[model samples]
Target: MKLKGSMWSCIGLATLLMAGCDKSPPISTAEEQPSAPKKQVAFQPDWVPKALGSGNFEVCLSNEAEENGVKDLILPVGMMFDSWGHMTGSLRDSKAFDGEGTSGFGKSDQYALALTARVHLTSDRPCAITQAQAVTHQGFRYRHETVPASLHYNFSAGGLYLNKKGGITNDMKGPAGDAAQIGLLSGTPISDVGDVYRATEDL
Candidate 1:
């Protein structure tokens, strides 16, 4: 993929979500005291990766199921953000295959899920993703794995991935074409997938 002329860098935040318990007693003063003004953080708009121009791309799914079983392939094609800081995306049903044991007859179905956004960068600023994670929303649990460097974006912190088992793997892989190809070809069982959600100093 050809990177744009703009220079990008990655900033690793120790925490994405902040939570705390108020242990101190509540103030009971009749007179209200002035409070300090809160700092206003600048808002930055998310940008579509150069590879996915206009934020449109086709999610390819190859039938890799054996000749005697049923298999399904799911992938993310669009991305969006919720009212909260959390990022979300739509899923695409790429292909489904039903193998015949002895009738020599089988069925193969192919489809695509059009998405307005498929990748969610944590920040608009340039940053390289040091980790990736596979977050399952449904179906059987699969092995987690780290994303390849080819897909890492200096501007985007992470992305989304849909597994065959009907689960979304968040920040688990880069959006690069080659990285997607590797995921499809590796045939790595979900049980043996490694964890790539943690930070990696090396790109």
Candidate 2:
């Protein structure tokens, strides 16, 4: 009987030792694990058009932000209107403007679209442009086309009269004008024109 009891005690000790050896530490949860930092994304502006007139047609800018930090300025040329005041077609143009120059105010970084449109207006009614809407890419500023103070507009001639800044005007009229022009006396480089649409903000 003594020998049998001693054997049972030895078996119990061995089992306990095996169980202790097989034990492992608890596993970690997903919340306890460290996560990598998120990357920063570049900012981009939405293509939403502000109200310009009683009609739905309005001048708008491109929401696309170029890598060189240039935004295209969109101008409304004209929109086809039915007899009932409904819009049938929209005509518009765009010019790339560099907001960042040696000075905060920069020139047109690219050629401007020759803005022209054919609208069927009644003889009694004359369509008039009252306001213009300027759009810029998100995270970018707008640079207006600069003209010499001497430049002036002549409504009767229907043409821009430029002096002293002749080269600038010539550049604006050239096939490869590098800046946007703002004035009544100069003709924009005539090329392909694009339509302007409302911009949506990118989150």
Candidate 1 global lDDT: 0.23
Candidate 2 per-residue lDDT over residues 18-90, each given as its tens digit: 8799888767886796866443222222212222234212222212113223333222232111001111122
- Cα displacement (angstroms), candidate 1, residue 66, comes to 43
lDDT of 1 by residue, 76-171 (tens): 342211011111111111111111111010111111121323332222211111112322121212112322222211111123344344444444
Candidate 2 Cα deviation (angstroms), residue 62: 14
lDDT of 1 at 40: 33
Score every model by TM-score.
0.21, 0.17
Model 2 reaches what TM-score against the true structure? Answer: 0.17
Regions of model 1 farther than 4 Å from truth? 1-23, 29-158, 175-203
RMSD of each: 20.2, 29.5
Q: Give candidate 1's total backbone clashes.
A: 19
**Candidate lDDT (C-alpha), each:** 0.23, 0.23
lDDT of 2: 0.23
